[model samples]
Target chain A: MQERSEPEAARGPRRGRGRRPTAEVRADVLDAAGALLLERGMGGFTIEAVAERAGVSKTTIYKWWPSKGALALDGYFHAVESVLAFPDSDDVEADLTAQLRAFVRILTGTPAGRVIAELIGQAQTDPELSAALLERYSDPRRELAVRRMRRAQTEGQLRPDVDPEVLVDQLWGACYHRLLMPSLPLVEEFATSLVANLLRGVRA
Target chain B: MQERSEPEAARGPRRGRGRRPTAEVRADVLDAAGALLLERGMGGFTIEAVAERAGVSKTTIYKWWPSKGALALDGYFHAVESVLAFPDSDDVEADLTAQLRAFVRILTGTPAGRVIAELIGQAQTDPELSAALLERYSDPRRELAVRRMRRAQTEGQLRPDVDPEVLVDQLWGACYHRLLMPSLPLVEEFATSLVANLLRGVRA
Candidate 1:
């Protein structure tokens, strides 16, 4: 995150301290933000530290994000999108079960899970961040799931009366419940059982 | 929550501050903690503020509760249990529907809901607080739900294969999803709809 943005190749012998390109600056800031967020956590994270580490001005970071929460949220969103994968196989249950296992694995075992938890924690208090996180992060992922579920419906694999929104909510809800409650474990087996039990109840 | 702490009546015209009874002190502390928690929320709340507002020493507050999070959590649990009721009618559906409606109503509308949200928000970070919240607050309520659902099983109203834990988790997960995501509305209609849809899936 303390960017190698210095571009050793460009530094040659003159070793100039000139401004980098706009895209590089943004990448550096987000990377610094992700590093700082994952390292120090939400409580200790700050925009100033990100600017210092990224070698970008606070004005430049603020020009794009508007606030510290927004920047941290951006970092979180970037991290989640990079790792999440969707299933596309013809079998709805296999596609769902496989993708869900992977999805839950990221949420339970990875830094991406931690970042989602942190962002969700703050989104409880900040309404704007809540909207930004959902619209930018949650909904797109959901649309992918919904598209697959509807495909299942058209293929006569899902119940005609099934509600995709509720269906997705139940799956993610269980995942989030496990994430939020330390008492509940979210292992791959539990994900498998949850999908089996829930889908058995709703499958066509 | 300000207790009647009737030493005031007993003290009569003197109305002296001479060492109130232990019960009175405890009640005052909890009331102050509740008031401060409801007003300032978890992030802004502190034991010192509760002590100052309650006219108790910081040592006294510390002696009763181990940490700021614990005291705040106790206040939240007290507030929630006071308003929450258990369902128990011969008709399990009617009983569950009414109680679920009330439970979700509290979750969606009252200060109790906000406190639950705050505790959950922090539980994402603090494992100790997460354990305390689940053990003290969530488990007892869940036990009550399990009890009623078991009775439903006995009466052959719910599927015998239905796992009570999973059944409860789905209901709670959906409610929590609503609580965590402000973009989604948590109205009475939604609660009713959620219960109807989920129960249909799990019914005998």
Candidate 2:
């Protein structure tokens, strides 16, 4: 968490002598933002705090991200990017099973679940945050999964008539439902079951 | 909406002389609460307003409902009860399709969608509300659908190994995802397609 920004903090006041790459600065800010959000939750997340921790200017952050919600979403995505990455395999079931398992692990084990839950909750009333969530997080993630499913369809692993968008919904949406409703525990087994049931069909 | 409460309001100060039936009084309060929620949302929904509108005592309302959120959920359910009822036709697919279509109509056509969204959003921060939503609303609704699916399984209409609970999530959860995220439109066709896709399976 602090590892990325620590070096930037140590190099304080030497801005003019050597400017960091845009990607590096962006990574540092997002890392700091994600760490702050995970540690303190949304109430403690502020642009000022992120700027200070990342050792970057507030103006720079605003220049890159439109709003706090946007920044928070980007940071959250950045933090979880590696873990939630969609995998492609010859067997669509294997790939989906792997990805959904990883997703359930994050939702059940990590602070990322709570963070995302809060973000979705807050987005209900906040238009800007809603836009950011849809544009930056949900849409991109859905597209990635949809893309994978599309490839599977081409490979004749999935039914030609199946709507990949709805498949995405049936699988991931079930997980999201458990996350939001909480009456059911979101276990990894549920993810595997979701894939198996969808693929095999429920018709006897 | 106001039809249920208008007569009660007209009854005014005649509380002690001719006390209304408990069931009738309960109906009036819930009607008032639902109407208030739909019209003004959670922000304007209050015990006092409901009491005044329903011509019931505050004590009676509290005795029946623990909190504003609980009242709102009950009220919302009462408002949409007839429309969202689960059907038990001979064909499981037809029953599911009919129920989901009705559910989609409420979500898209009425104010219920925004009201539930607001309730869910607030529930994230309010434990009491979350409990009310689960116990009084989500859990019961889920039970109804699951029972219907379980019956289908026993009748050999559904796969024996299929998890009814997961099936419920896959269908209803997808609708909720669209409602909460709003990146996709929640249409009647989507509901029909959801039932069809789930019944037939998505395998090639």
Candidate 3:
């Protein structure tokens, strides 16, 4: 891990570098990294590559991220931060079905899907990265899913005995498998079918 | 891709001044590579490394596998070929649930899990490798799952309207997400809960 205590050299001081790049600059760096990741894939991606692509200084990147995994996580966090929003309709089944279908489409129809698969793969290799990814990305989505499932159960649309957290895990897991494995196509029709099948057993 | 007409070292004679390596010797090389992959990660693994580990010439490896991806695929195929066996029992729900739990445990509990995750990541970068992975490894399990789900539907355990392929995808996807994402605690209890939830929705 790169030690953070050292006063890193300022990168490309704009007018002698105006006050370390702001959050917007950091966001741009992450966006650049994400785009580079989709283009070059993770194998060829590096901090220098991201810095060059973002047109930011390596020191600026280092100031923001301690390691490549950290940088990737930053990008992942931004990409997936708002993806798991649960529906608000009183009809729990419709709400679950809609959210799940949207989730499936987002994963199968975008570059972020591939990026996420690669990140998950890296997590398998690096335990620290795995921990960070779960905490920064997976946990919040899971909690939101769980909360929605619980709300649905309370509305009498789902079995009260069903564990909301576990159901959410299973739903997400199924989505991951479909996206990464791709042995089964993840069309909207398939998503609707899956949500229906799952609800058949759990819906009260 | 390298032309398939002849081995890269077709001109090279058998290394033996007194003993030439045979076809069996080629299998031995792949076997050694598999062992090395199980022991060492891809970064530290190389054709030269495999040759050294196998006590064979690098020429033999190149003759068999044009790239490291091909070699890694061989290893992965060897490991997963026997890992996913669908139950043949008549009690569809019981058998499916048992198999589901077993699949979850095997995928997340072993080094193969990490290896599979890395391969998935690699696949994102290599389309040919991804196709090969799905064709040889991913599809067989899917085929078996589809077969089982279809059987259940015929037996009236599953609703006639449920699409077998879609249901299998959902189940497999969910388990896969848990394994690769490391978002959910992979435990038998969680698997059981998922099984129950899906069963409620799918059972006729």
Candidate 4:
């Protein structure tokens, strides 16, 4: 299990302060929520638990986050935001390789994989979660990669005729497939091999 | 909604001269189960309903399939079996194109997509269903495609260094991504564009 501590502000006495900054309070709540989610899955996740952990009232939590699903999405993304960032090096292949490697590492090495799988699974039934996942997480991440690919195309590193969106699908989609349907183990070298095979093509 | 009539044998009288063949009974049960699944999502699916519709005893269903998930998977596969078959034409590109097109059609045109999405979603919490899905459905389908790609490699159509498994992921994985995520519509021409972009390489 990954160890994520609640933000310092969340741990401090709530009565002594003249209302903590909104950003600090948000971070505290998310941190507490994320730690709880990582420690115990959706089954154990509750707004009451989060409020207690963060030293905030349930009303305050509810005011910002409409539902538990919404909070979970935000918390999960906040916990993983830094690690999944895309790089913009001079070389497209190198940048993609680095970014994908980071992605695979977080997915395979951390609790994020299971957390995400559960979220996606529950999203099948929960319409709000499904819409939030698309709008907040998946779509934005895809846009980042697509933007990078378009830049690569402009620089003549990637073929202009190729659709950047489909390229995004081929790369990240494969990882998600292995994650969701784990017939084959997601190997350590998968990121390298995927980038190589996709850029080079399979034609003889 | 797709109209699927119950098998004639199942619709016929149960007090026949002799016991019906196991294969025929199995077919009847699957037909009934598939129709029910397609018509109503997992929420409405029940063993009692299937047994009543198929004109078979509940004991028969339980004997063959231990859980509802197992039965649903088998029934869903049986329903979509014919359309999802991989072709072995001399041209790998044409074969992949035709097969992916069929796959996308089934996913978009029929109720199989929703059925599968629901199954996969439910599989997250259900261990037996997860195992059954991988072993019975996803793994076998991947094997079929991998086998076709290997044949293509032997014929020198696909490069020898490339991993056939990864190729499967890139193509089918992309389709699955679009189906599950739905940020972008699984467009009609996606199959063709996916194949062309992948095989030709993105490198300038």
Whole-model lDDT, model 1? 0.71
lDDT of 2 by residue, B1-204 (tens): 545545654655545423777888888888888778777777788999998887777998889888888999998988877777877678999999999999999887877888898888778787888889899889988998999999998999999888999998899998998898887889999998888888988889
True contacts kept of each: 0.35, 0.73, 0.64, 0.74
Candidate 2 scores an iRMS of 0.8
Model 1, span B1-204: residue lDDT tens: 434344545535323343677777787777777767666666668888887677777888888787777888777756656555655677766676677688777776656667778788878778888777787767776787788888888888777777777666676767787788654666666656556665565222
Candidate 3 per-residue lDDT over residues B1-204, each given as its tens digit: 122234636524443322554665665566666667666656666888777655567776777677777777776666555555777877766777788887777666655566666778678667887887787668876788888777777777777776766666556666667767776667777666666777766222
TM-score on alpha carbons, each prediction: 0.76, 0.93, 0.72, 0.90
Count of residue pairs whose backbone atoms collide, per candidate: 0, 0, 11, 0
RMSD for each of the candidates: 5.2, 2.3, 8.6, 3.3
Count steric clashes of candidate 1: 0
How high a TM-score does candidate 4 get? 0.90
Scoring model 4 with DockQ, what do you get?
Answer: 0.77
lDDT (Cα, 0-100) at B185 in candidate 4: 84
Alpha-carbon deviation at A198 in model 4, angstroms? 1.3
Q: What is the lDDT, from 0 to 100, of the residue A186 in candidate 3?
A: 72
lDDT of 1 by residue, A3-91 (tens): 24666465454222335667877887788887777666677679998877776668888888977878887776565555556667777
Runs with alpha carbons beyond 4 Å of true place in candidate 2:
A1-9, A12-18, B1-14
lDDT of 4: 0.82
lDDT tens digits, residue span A1-204, model 2: 535445664665634322888887888889989888877777788999998887778998998998889999998888778888877669999999999999999877877778888889888888888999999889988998999999999999998888888887899988998998888999999999999888888988
Better of 2 and 4 by DockQ: 2
Clashing pairs in 2: none
Query: Could you arrange the candidates by lDDT from highest to lowest?
Result: 2, 4, 1, 3
Residue B84 displacement in candidate 3 (angstroms): 3.2
**Chain B alone, TM-score of each model?**
0.77, 0.90, 0.70, 0.88
Where model 1 places Cα greater than 4 Å from the true spot, the runs are: A1-7, A10-60, A202-204, B1-62, B90-92, B154-156, B159-162, B202-204
